[model samples]
Target: MKLHGVDYTSAPSRRKGITIASGELHGDVLILESLTSLPDHAAFDAWLRQPGPWLGAFDFPFSLPRELVEHLQWPTEWAPLMRHVTSLTRPEMRETFKAFCDARPVGGKFAHRATDFPAGSSPSMKWVNPPVAYMLHAGVPQLLAAGVTIYQLHPGDPDRIAFEGYPGMVARDITRASYKNDLRSKQTPARREARERIVGMLEAGQHRWDVKLDAGDFREALVDDGSGDLLDAALCAVLAAWAWQRREARYGMPEFDALEGWIVGA
Candidate 1:
C-alpha cells in the first residue's frame, strides 16, 4: 500500500527518520499543530480560508457521549446539533459541557456517545487530561470554516467518513490502558515496557485494523533539519501507521465526498 500524501504545514514537518510508504498524501490531510499554543480567532480564521487536503481532524472528542448530549438537552439531531454547537462561544461551550459533567456521577463523569469509546476518544469536555473540549473549540471552527463535512454518527448521517479518528482508542487497545501519558508517569519501567510492547506490535505488523505504523522507521531519528519539526507529524505518522494496520471496517467504511466533508479537487 503506497502512502501518498501532502502534509498541510507552514514548514516541511515530516520526520527525517520516516521510511516506507512515500507518496504525497493528498494536500488536504492537514497538519493543524497549534502555532502559538493557543492560536487566536484571527489565525484560526486565516487558516480556515486556505483550500485544504485536511478534511477534518483527529479530534479528542469528535462528538460528546450520548448521555451528555441528552443531559444538556442539546439538539439531539446532528445537523442542528453541529449548528447549535458552533453557534456557542468558547466560554459557552466549556460552561455548558462542564455543567453537564458536574451533575453526573463521579465514576461516570462525562456522558459519552457510542462512537466515543469505540473511537477511543478522550472526553472533549474533560477539564484535565488533554481537555478535548478545547480541541473542539480549536478544531470545529476550522471544519466549519472549511465547510468540510464530518463523519457523524448522528440521526441522518450514519455512514459518513471522518477526517480525524480517535486513534488513541486504537493505540490503547493494542497497548492496553497501561501506558499513561504524563511525563513522570510515562518514564516508569512498567510504562516503558508497555510502550515497548506497543512498539513491538507496530513493528511486527500486529494491529491489521490500523494503517501500518512502521515504528522502527523513525526510532533512531532526532528531528527534521528541513522543517525543524517532527513531533506532531510523527504522532500523525503513528496514527497513520495504526490506521493502516486496522481492518477497513474500523474506518466504518467512511464516505469521502463534498457533502461528506472532502473538498473536491482541493
Candidate 2:
C-alpha cells in the first residue's frame, strides 16, 4: 500500500499551500516518491478524490475534545458532531470557543483531548498560536465530503484510511531546539543546522519508530525550506509508513474515545 503524509493549512495560498508527501514503504525504509502542493481547497479536494489503496497521516485534529463537546452539548456522535461544527461560520466558532475559554481558569483555559498530552499537540480548540481550531473547521468538512475513512471515527472507503499525525511529536524525539521559522529574517544558520540534524537522524533510523527515510535528492530541499513545511510533510510520511508497518495492530493506535480521535505514533 502507498503511504501519504499531509502538512495542512486552513487557508491555502501560493506561499502556504497544503503540502503532501507520498511514498512507499520498503522494508524498514520510507522512500519518498513525490511532493505535491495544493494551493486551494479545490486542489485538496481533487487530490482526496484520487483512487487510493493508500493511507494518509494528516497534520490536523480530526475531532474536538469530548470535554468541550459535552460542555457545549453538541452531538455526541462523530458525523453529527462534525455536521454541527461545519454548519457554523468561522466567527461563530471563534466566539463559541472564546466563550468556553473565558469561563475557565487562566492556565486551564483550553479544553484538551486525551491524545493531546501524549501527542504533544496544541488544543484543537485553540484559535491562535497555530490556530488548530480554524484548521479543524476548514479541513474536516472536506474530509467528510470526500468520503474517506477516518480510521476509528468514521467509515467510508476502506482503501483510503486517514490517521491524525503530529510532526512535532517526531521532531521533539530528535531535538528540542527550534528548527523552523516562517519569517525570512528568523531563518538563521542555527535553525538550518537543526534541520540538518533532524535529517541525519531520520536517515540513520534514530527515532522511536526505527524507520529510515530515503529522501534522496529531496534531503537538501527538506533542510533548506526554512518554513519547514516540506520537512513536516516528510516526517508525517515517516509516521504513516510506521503505521502501515503495524496495520494489523490498528495502525499503532491505542483504544481511545471514538469521539476524540488519536494522533498516530503519539
Candidate 3:
C-alpha cells in the first residue's frame, strides 16, 4: 500500500513547510521512496487532491477536547464543529482557550482528550509552546476540503484515509533526549547523534511497531536535517505502516470519542 507520514506546520514558508515521507509497504517492511516539501498552502492543497489509494498518518490533532467543546457549546458533531472552529480567528481561539485555562486551577489548566495521556501529547487546545491548536486550525480544514476520510470520525474519500499520529510518542519510545531544534545555531552534534540513534533503531526494528524501515539513500538527509522534520515524517510513516497492518481491525484504534479523535496506536 502507498503510505505517508507528514510533519505539518500551521504556517508554511520556504524555511518551515510541511514535510512528507512517502513510501510503499512490502510485506512488513516499509520502503522509504521520497521526501516531499509543501512550502505553501496551495502546494499542500494540490498534494491532498492527488488521487490516493493511500493512507497517511499526520502529525496534527484532528479535533478538540470534548470538555473544551462542551464548555464552549460548539457543535458536537465532527463536520459542524470543524466549521465552527474555522469561524474563529487564531487570536480568537487563543483568547477562548486562554479564558478556559485561566479559570481552572494551576496544573489542571488544559482540558484533555482521553487519548492525550496515553499518547503523551500536548492538549489540542493549547495555543502556545508547540502551538498545536493553530496546527489543528490550519490542517484539519484542508483535510475536510480535500474529502479525505478521517478514520472513525468523518467519511469522505474511502481510498484516502487519515489518522491522527504522534511522532513524539514514537521518538520517545527510542529516547527522550532532545533530537531537534529549529534554530540552526542550536542544532548540535549531540542532537544529530540522537537522530542517528533513532534512525538506527528504526533500521533494526526496535520500535513499538516492530517494522523495520528501508530508508535507502535518504538516511543521511534524515540525520543531517537536525530540525527533525524529516525524521518525524519517517516516524509517522512507521506508525502508518503499523496501522495498515491492522486495517481490518479498526486500524488498531480502541473505542474513542468520535468528536475527540484518538491518536492512532496510542
Candidate 4:
C-alpha cells in the first residue's frame, strides 16, 4: 500500500512549509520514495484531494482533550465538534481558550488527552509555541473535506487513513541528542551528527519497526535537511509503514477515546 508521513504547518511559505515523505512497504522494509513540500494551504488541500488509496501518518493533533471539550460544553462528537472548532477564527479560538485557562488554576491551565503522556506531545489546546490547536484547526477539516478516514475518530473514505504522528517519539527512540532546530542559527554540527545517527538508525531498522531505508537520494535527503522537516516526515513515514504492516492489528495504537484520537506510534 502507498504510505506517507507529513510534517505539517498551519501557515506555510516557500522557506518554511509542510513536508511529505512518500514511500511504500516492501516486506519488513519501508522503501523511501520522494519528499514533497506544500508551501501553502491551497497546495496542501490540493495534495489531500489527489486520488489516493494511501495511508498517511500526519504530524498534527487530530482531536482536543475530552475534558476541555466537556468543560467548554461543546459538541462531544467528532464531526460536529470539528465543525464547531473550524467555525471560529484563530483569534476567537485564542480568546475562548484563554478564557478557559483563566477560569482554572495556574498549574492546571490545559487539559490533556490520554495519549499525550506517552507521546510526549503538547496539549492539543495549546495555541502558542507549537500551536497544535491551530494546527488542528487548519489540518483536520481539510482532511475531513478530502474524505480521509481518521482511525477511531472520524469515518470518511476508507481508502485513505490518517493517523496522528509525533516525530519526536521516534527521534528520541534513536538518540537523546538534539537533531534539529528550525532557527538557522541553531543548526549546529552536533545537530547534524544527530541527524546522521537518526538516518543510520532508520537504515539499520534500529527503531524496531523492522523497516530499512532504500539506498540513495531519499536517504541523503533525510540527512541533508538540517531543519529536520524531511527527517521528521521520514520518521512518520516509518510509523505509517509500521501501521500498514499491522493494518489488521489496529496499528499498535491502544484503546483511545473516540474524541481524543491516539498518536500512531506513541
Candidate 5:
C-alpha cells in the first residue's frame, strides 16, 4: 500500500511546518521516495482530500483523555466530542483545561490515555510544549472532512486509514542518542551521529518488524535537518509501512478506547 508519515504543526510556516514522508512498502522494506513540506493547515487539508488509496501515520493525537472528557462532562462519544473541541478557540481550550488541572491533585494534573504509557506520549490536553491539543484541533477535523478512516476511531473511507503515530517511541527504542530537535542550538554533531545510528538500525531490520529501508541516500536525508522533523516524519513513515505490512494484525495496536485512540506501532 502507498504509505505516508506526517510530522504535523498546528501553525505551519515556510521556514518550518508539516513534512510528509511518502513511500511504498516492498517485500520487507519501505522505499523512501520523497519528502514534501506543507506550509499551513489549509495545504494539509487539501492534501488530505487528494484522491488516492493511502494509509498515513500522523504525528498527532486522534482523541483526548477519556478521564478529562468525563471530568469536564463533555460529549463522551467520539464524533460529538470532536465537534465540541473543534468549536472552541485555543484560549478557551486553555482555560477549560487549566481549570480541570487546577481542581486535580498536583501529581495528577493531566489525564492520560491507556496508550500514553506505552507510547510515552504527552497528555492530549496539553496546550504548550508540544501543543498537541492544537494539532488535534487542526488535524482531526480535516481527516473527518476528508472522510479518512481513523482505524478504531470514527470510520469513514477504509482505504485512507489515518493512524496516530509517535516517532519518539521508535527513536527511543532504536538509540540512546538524541536524533532531532526543534532548536537549532541542540542539533549537534552527536545528534547527527545518533540519527545515522538510528538509520543503520532501521536498515538492518533491528526494529524486528521484518522491514528495512530501501538502498538510497536516506541516512543523509534523515539527518540533514537539525529540527528532526524530517527524520521524525521518516520514522512515522516506517511505522506506517510496518502497520500496513501487519494490517491484519491490527498494526500491533492494542484494542483502544473509542474516545481515546491508540498509537499505531507504539
Candidate 6:
C-alpha cells in the first residue's frame, strides 16, 4: 500500500483518445444522447489488462463476492480451488455454475458482482442480478491466473505479495449508504450530487492522502451505473482521476504516503 500507482476502467470514452483525465469529457462523448461515449465491455477489459503501474479497479473484483463463493461451494478458498478456478476452461466453469443455478429459485439465483457494494450484495449465486452471475463467471477465473490474492472472495488475507483493489469502497463513503452504489434505478439525483461534491473536493485539494495510522480527513467520489458492468470501472475512473492528480504531484499532493489508508483518502 505504498501509493505506487492508480487504476482506471477504460470507459465513458471522452473521445477517440484525448483528455482521458482532465475532469473534462469530449464534445462527441458529451452529447448526452449518444451511447458512443460509453466504451464497450471488450474495450473496458482490454484497458484493464494493459500493463504497468496501476493499483486496481472497479471493472470486476480481483475476487468474487463472498455470497457467491459460499453458495456455489466452489471452494475458491485456499490453495486448491483458487488454483482450480485459475486453470478450468471457461466452458467447464460455465457448465458447473449453470448446474448450480439450475437448481436454485427463480427470483433469486445468479451470482452478484463484488462491486455491488453497500447495496447489500446478494447471495452471489442469486440470479436476480443477472449478468453479474456471468461477471462472477468471467471475472474470478482471471484473478486465479494472475495469481492475485482472493481470500473469501474479497482479497481478505491477500496474496501477501500482490496489490489489487475493488475501488468501490471509496465511492460508498460519500453518503455512507447503499442505494447510491447501485447501478440500477435507485441511484437518485441526490446521489449524483454527492459524488460530484467529492469529485469537487479532490479538484480543490481538500483532503490528506497520508496513510498514517491516525491521519484523518478522507474524501471521495461515487457514481451509480445503470448497468453494473461499468459500475466498478466508473468508480475506477474516479479513482484514476484522483490518481492522475496524485501522480502528477509525485504522490505529494497530500493524498498519499506509507502503507495504509485508501488511495482516495480512505
Q: For residue 58, give model 4's deviation from the true position in Å.
A: 0.5
List, residue by residue over 47-136, the lDDT tens digit for candidate 4: 987777899999999999999999899999988999999999999999999999999998998889999998888999999988999999
TM-scores for every candidate against the unseen true structure: 0.58, 0.99, 0.99, 0.96, 0.96, 0.42
lDDT per residue for candidate 5 within 169-244, as digits (tens), equals 8888888677877788888999888888888888888874557876376668776788888888888998899898
lDDT of model 5 at residue 153? 83
Per-residue error for 153 in candidate 1, Å, reads 7.1
Mind giving the per-residue lDDT tens digits that candidate 6 earns over 1-266? 21121222223343321111112222211111111122444554453344433333233333444555666666644444445555665567667677867787996556544334333333333323433334444555544445443322334223221223333454444335333433445667765666555444433334332111110122222233322222333333444334434444632224321211122322
Give the deviation of candidate 5 from the true structure as CA RMSD: 1.4
Q: What is the lDDT of residue 4 in candidate 4?
A: 94
lDDT of 1 by residue, 1-266 (tens): 22211122211122222111122222323122222221244544454454433322232344555566666778766556666777887688878877776777888877654444445555555645656566555555554554544543322222212345443444465666454333543445665565555555644446634333442344333122122122233333445433333325543334432111221111
lDDT of 2 by residue, 1-266 (tens): 98999999999999899999999999999998998888999999999988989999999999999999999999999889999998999999999999999999989999999999988999999889999988999999888889999999999999898899999999999999999998999999999999999999999999998889999878889999999999999999999999999998988899999999899998
Candidate 4: segments with Cα more than 4 A from true spot: none
In order, what lDDT does every prediction score? 0.42, 0.93, 0.94, 0.89, 0.87, 0.37
Ranking by lDDT: 3, 2, 4, 5, 1, 6
Write model 3 residue lDDT over 1-266, tens digit each, in one string: 78999999999999988999999988888999999888999899989888989999999999999999999999999889999999999999999999999999999999999999999999999898999999999999999999999998899899999999999998999999999999999999999999999999999899888889999999999999979999999999999999999999999999998999999889
Clashes (backbone N, CA, C under 3 Å), per candidate, total: 37, 0, 0, 0, 0, 13
- Candidate maximizing lDDT: 3
> Which has the better TM-score: candidate 3, or candidate 5?
3
Q: Is candidate 1 or candidate 5 better by TM-score?
A: 5
